[model samples]
Target: VPQDEQDIAGQWRTFVENNRLDAVVCIAAALRRGVLDEAEASRYQRPAVNLHQPWELSGLGQLHEAAQNADRLVCFGGD
Candidate 1:
């Protein structure tokens, strides 16, 4: 999904919840782009966190694990 689409209210939450899916945000990528979760926000003394529930900030290892365990995997990226 596009970066702008990410901040849209409740879309990701509802989709993930309804589908019983898990979403992980890459920690390094998120921090680099100023997309912080609650803990990160507090640690960095930021006033707010844009990333919320139904979406968790995690390392790429989690993504690898998820992919390894998934029945189907669809990845989108550009080198």
Candidate 2:
């Protein structure tokens, strides 16, 4: 994983452990890069917003896609 991803994972790990969050929202790239893992997602039996990034969509594309998927998945999103 890149240094930035490592940084994010480290920070989130601390936050999650400290607060015992019931869910997590993260970019799919982190999961694919191993920055985030299943154990983390399942730590609290919580749901995750694994935002997907498609090459076809540039800026805000992933966000839009995530929102659309969220609807299908019964999740919610905001601008």
Candidate lDDT scores, in order, read 0.87, 0.48
Q: Pick the candidate with the highest lDDT.
A: 1
Q: For model 1, how does the per-residue alpha-carbon lDDT over 11-44 read when each residue is reduced to its tens digit?
A: 7678889999888888999999999999999999
What is candidate 2's TM-score against the reference? 0.26
TM-score of each: 0.73, 0.26
lDDT per residue (tens digit) for residues 1-79 in model 2: 6854568656656776677643434435455554434454575464763332211112346557766777564545666
Q: Cα RMSDs of all predictions?
A: 4.6, 12.8
Among all candidates shown, the one with the greatest TM-score = 1
